[model samples]
Target: MIPTNIVVHQHSKVLELSYDGGAIYKLPFELLRVLSPSAEVQGHGPGQETLQTGKRDVVISSLEPVGHYALKPTFSDGHDSGLYSWDFLYFVCENQEQLWKEHLDKLALAGLDRDAPMTTKGHSCGSH
Candidate 1:
């Protein structure tokens, strides 16, 4: 289900998506940034994911439509690679709570904090 309306609430730091049947979702900027599907965040394969940190204050600087299938948002932190697909957005909206819990669990397991600064790490591929 594609969102009928998309609003970037700068003050609230959320991307509001309105769908049919009066369903609405407000995705936080931090959530979007941390869970970005881009390779930079997700990595090239399983177990290679890069955990995102220090994105609590991230903001969407611009939002662009990607051929009617997705949205490309340029974040204030200069991240613009993730292309959020319609289905992917819907899934995130529906599973927001669970996803957040899982993310927190991972952070705890890694002995990391969400507000901590992201450290520069070398990737196996030798590429950023």
Candidate 2:
């Protein structure tokens, strides 16, 4: 049987979820984003995942529950894709530590930092 409780430790970056099957899981924020199902990050086809960088300090501003088994997460960066399903949330929470480490490794190999400065384009950025 799965448990039925969902809790988040924002400061520690931990997301605790309980399933109705007597199972509980705790996941990290970074891991969740890295494994987001959004097209911009996951791509439109196989072997086409776009790495998300400069999100180290990103936090979950809001977690709006969508229906009874999904979530609409609003991040501090204003990116709100990647609807998290029940199974997906369970997966992440179950394997948080390892997944987080892997993300760190990937960032290191790519030589990118979540806090790195990125030049914004468009008229809003002022002058070309």
Candidate 3:
């Protein structure tokens, strides 16, 4: 179900997705960036996923709709490719805690932290 309202709370760095059923999800910008569905984040195939780091302070510069399916959020750090589909976004809202934990685990395994400077070199959206 597509959200009835999408509010980007820049001060708090959260994206609020409100549904018709009154479900509201406050997703952090960092979480969104890390979980972006683009190939840049998910890669072209299994086991090729790139670990995103140092995005704790990332903010949404803008949110652009894509046709009738997803949103393209331009991040302050210059990332503007991941297409957050309705299905994916709903999944994110439903499993936010688990997804966040997984992201943290991945970061830890890579010896990285969200607060660190983004230095891990890897593709991150439509080509640079």
Candidate 4:
């Protein structure tokens, strides 16, 4: 297994997630929504992932720790389904540059930017 570590560097308007295994993911609330690991984003299975779009300035409103292995994140737009587990977090970190690049690629494919329009709907975007 690959090594991993997660650190939350909350910003004034953005929430930064750092990994010790190499890779720093600066996840804004909106980006987090689109990248949510829930069915909305992850979809039913492989090749069914719904690419997240139109999120640039998304900021995490809350970061609640579920025990010690996962996180229950609540975004400003009210989307949470991505229970960021330590293992998952480490995975993201280990592949930060690649994942972020893919994220940007998808954003570009959707004609979205880093500061897109904000939505009003809010819901659980994470797991227990």
Candidate 5:
């Protein structure tokens, strides 16, 4: 289900997707950044997922279409690896509430705060 229209609201920090049925979904920039499907965020496998912090003010610097199947967004933080497919975007639109809750839970469990800055001390690879 490809979106009929896609708009990036810089001031509000949301990516709005409108479908054929007039259903519109607004995904926050922070949500998109934290939930990015790239290896840097999702990691190579399941448990290796990295917890994204200090992304509350993250913004989409640019958006590029990917072969008519997905969108690649360059975030203000310089992250641009995630390719958001139509299906994945739809799923995200539908499950944003639950996803946000889960993210908050993870942050709490990790003794971290949503607005905290990302630390490089534990990331020995220096990939981030």
Candidate 6:
């Protein structure tokens, strides 16, 4: 699955992925950060997802291609272990709204701020 075009908008902090069928997806850096496919975020098994917070202002520092099927994005926050496969990226694009809403819900449940550190003076996600 070759994306016809992949453009990273540094100014807008978004990644635009366009497929041959004319579907285009605009994904924000913060969204990508929170939904990273790395084990650090996804954990090794189900029910072990680590909630990602304090990424409201995160930006993509660079996007590196992995052979022929994935992208490795390095974020400004220093996270770079996730290898975004073509299928995974497409999935994110197709289910962006729902995924984003769920992320927000989880944050609310944990009382975490998207823009503030979890360990900030008064901010907490109720996670130890």
Candidate 6 residue runs with Cα over 4 Å from true position: 118-128
Q: Rate the local accuracy (lDDT) of all candidates.
A: 0.94, 0.71, 0.89, 0.62, 0.94, 0.88
After superposing candidate 2 on the true structure, give the runs of residues whose Cα lies further than 4 Å from its correct spot: 1-3, 20-23, 114-128
- Candidate 4, TM-score vs. the true structure? 0.64
Which should have the higher lDDT, number 2 or number 6?
Answer: 6
Better of 1 and 4 by lDDT: 1
The most accurate candidate by TM-score is 1
**Residue range 18-128, candidate 6, lDDT tens digits:** 999798989999999999999778877797778888887888998999999999999998999999999999999989999999999998988877776744333233443
Q: Which order, best to worst by lDDT? A: 1, 5, 3, 6, 2, 4
Better candidate number, 5 or 6, judged by TM-score:
5
| TM of each candidate vs. truth | 0.95, 0.73, 0.90, 0.64, 0.94, 0.88
> What is the model-wide C-alpha lDDT for candidate 3?
0.89
Tens-digit lDDT string for candidate 2 (38-85): 775777778666767766666788888877768878777777888888
Error of 3 at 5 (Å): 0.9
**lDDT digits (tens) for residues 21-49 of candidate 4:** 55555544554566677776686768767
* Alpha-carbon deviation at 68 in model 4, angstroms: 3.0
CA shift of 123, model 3, Å: 6.0
lDDT (Cα, 0-100) at 25 in candidate 4: 59
- Candidate 4, residue 39: the lDDT equals 76
**Which pairs of residues collide in candidate 5?**
none
In candidate 3, which residue pairs clash? none
- Cα lDDT, model 3, residue 72: 94
